[model samples]
Target chain A: MKMTKIVRTTADVFYPFCLVFGLYVVIHGHLTPGGGFQGGAVMATGAALLIVAHAYEDITGRIRKTAMKILEAIGLLTFLFAGLSGILFHRPFMANWMAQTGKLFGNTVAHGPNPGDLNTAGLLPLLNVGVGIEVLGGLTVILLYMLSGIKEEKKP
Target chain B: MTPFLLLQALILLGLIVTGALIIAFKDLLAAAIAFAAFSLLLSIEFYILQAPDVAIAEAGIGAGLTTAIFLIAIRGTKRFEEKE
Candidate 1:
């Protein structure tokens, strides 16, 4: 069963906010309190909001299960590659080799506390993005699977 | 007692109350909602304890995703508990 129009409308309005906020959390994970898992769960919460507001058939068209599966795979690959990159650089696995090297996400910072820089944490932000998307895809796919189970139960 | 301590106490009391409510409710939906409230209070407690990371995780997973999952499960099953 679908929710009321008001509920759907509210979910639509808040969906982008959730997505953006979750992205912010993921991107700023190194400098902020939340990290990949938390941010991804927040984004998944948005997906859940949308899924709960609409019917299964209606939602499947917008958020295909195959797409979610692909997303999950991509995220895992990204994370694995990011970790494996340290081996290529002759460092330990998942090393922060890029830090203080004056490259992308490698800027140096002062010792004391102050406004944080986005380019300060090397490898961490990349790992965060990887994990964030992985959790999002995984959680959303679980919900979709549950919903599909409900649909199947009603059939026969 | 300090105001911070008072606030913490109040939140802890709320946590216990909500925890009990989750068990006491006959309607599974109501129990799920109470669980959400319990999660929220626990997140707040985490924040006040100087662990914002745990707080954020708790709020997102415990308060948000878990509640949605529970609601979906209830939708698939019965809303009210069956008598033994």
Candidate 2:
């Protein structure tokens, strides 16, 4: 228990730094080896650290079960919506619609200074973000159920 | 060896060790902690494998959330005792 406290404190102190680094991983994922999912998970570690340090009561009050459930549902729906949008636009499912927009940092990234650059990859970044959100939300719900004290009844 | 590969190997080793401990340990609380470690290590392995999405899912749901649940469950149940 004493050891757990020490570990928890260290992790809590380390969380902010981890969050920043996780964002970097997500934003630069297209250029590097990481993406939204990886970064989001890393971000989740920050929450993990807090839970360990402060205990579940402290954390649960901040992140209500109702909100988490809503986020999970929304995330899944958003992902499906994106796919449907592609179909509605007369394109195949999961078509790169952002390619038509042809903008980066508010302007066209392709055919600009960094032509055919990794940053210019159409719709991939957005897709990555969506996937990340969905994964995070879904995982959170699963974890919540596991953490909640609802037990299975035994039969005589 | 690349840093990514090195991390990957370390995470995998941690995962295996924790998994073994979780199975071998009779104490439910210790086993829960070991399982949490297993989840954390698995997340790191996922990151090293260039699957950040999966890594995040594992870290949040597997390590962070699951550990909390285990702690609560432990509170609700009887602690493990040695067999006579």
Candidate 3:
């Protein structure tokens, strides 16, 4: 295969791996180091790769810019809601509100027989997910807009 | 002599090199690519420094979104210029 073809094939394989790895980082954020922001950025890179390798028209057809914008906004609102709900409940902002004591996915997070279990922890995980989605969607929208703009410029 | 300190020193060196390269490079496109690398390295440094939240934000906003914007801007501008 030619160099360009090789690059395209590698990107095609790498995109799925990036997406899966990104999800793993986001989901296991509580126990591990990576979180939503990092994961989301990683995920967005997959989209970036696709944009770089494939035609703009093809990417646009699959990923609607308007929908991505809406999703991004919703993600931000979800994060805000999670934070404010803690304040409304007389807890600190972004406090851990979940049970936090039980076992989650076979991992003993917080100590048992107490309210501070890992499973029942506050809203950090949820917040992480929200932030991840927001970052991914927002970046996608920006990239798409820029690409479309470039296409339009080339046409005239 | 500790491994942790060694890692920190390496990350700091990366940041400095990236910053210098960004300033020294004449090509805006190259600088923009370096900027993304800078962001990623800085995020790693942040993680090592125990500031995961800031690191995450930097990785996403700085590395991901900012790079995309820069590339777009570069496409809109002249590709090359005489060195001054």
Candidate 4:
């Protein structure tokens, strides 16, 4: 069954703002108070809003399980690749190899209580992105599975 | 009492009320919505406690996602708790 008009409108109006905020939290993990897990869950909330507003059948086509699986795989693989890259470069696994290296995300942070710099986190941002994608995919996949399973339970 | 502390106390009270409502309501949908409200209050409490990361996570997973999941489950099963 479809939701009331107000619910649909609320979902539409809130989704874009939630998406942007989630991405901001993910990207600014090192510079801000939120990290990959938190931001990813935030983004997942937007997906949930839409799912709740629409019937399972109307949404299953768009929020495909296969696509979420692929996204989850890519996110985890990217995180592992990052960690192993440290080993390949003769550093310990998951080491901050790029910190203060004058490269991407390599700016030196001040010693104490300074405002955060987005460009100074050194591989953390990448890791955050990876985790964010993974969490979002994982949560959505779970939701899709539940919705799909319950579809059959509906009384004829 | 300081204004901030007063505000915090009110929020805490709201949280308690909502938490009770979650259990007290026989309608599963109302309970789910109450749970969402409880989560939202908890998120605010986290924020007040200087844990914005936790606050955002709670707001998202607890308030938003969990409520939706509960509603979906309710749709699958039944909206009202059956009298035993």
* TM-score, per-candidate, Cα-based: 0.94, 0.63, 0.76, 0.88
> On residues A1-156, what C-alpha lDDT tens digit does candidate 2 reach at each position?
123767777976798876787677666666665777777666656655665566555667876667867766776676677777788779988877766465652234534343234555666666666666665555555555555544322222
Alpha-carbon runs more than 4 Å astray in model 1 = none
- lDDT (Cα, tens digit) per residue for candidate 4, span A1-156: 669999988988887877898899999998888889988888887777778777667777787889999999998988998888899789999988988787899998768898788888788999999999999899999888888768777656
Show where candidate 3 strays beyond 4 Å.
A1-3, A87-95, A99-120, B1-14, B40-44, B47-65, B81-84
Q: By lDDT, who's the top model here?
A: 1
* Decoy 4 TM-score against native: 0.88
List ranges where model 4 is wrong by over 4 Å.
Answer: A4-14
Query: How well does candidate 1 match the true structure in TM-score terms?
Result: 0.94
DockQ of each: 0.79, 0.32, 0.55, 0.67
lDDT per residue for candidate 1 within A1-156, as digits (tens), equals: 789999999999989999999999999999999999999999998999899888778999999899999999999999999999999989999888888888999899878898899998889999999999999999999999988877888898
Among all windows of 10 consecutive residues in model 2 chain A, the one with the lowest summed lDDT is A147-156
Worst window of 10 by summed lDDT in candidate 4 chain A: A147-156
Give the candidate number with the greatest TM-score: 1
lDDT, candidate 3, B3-68, per-residue tens:
999999998999999999898788888899889989999989988889986787687678767887
Assess candidate 1 and give its lDDT. 0.92
lDDT-sorted candidate list, best first: 1, 4, 3, 2
The candidate with the higher lDDT, 1 or 2, is: 1
* Better candidate by DockQ, 1 or 4: 1
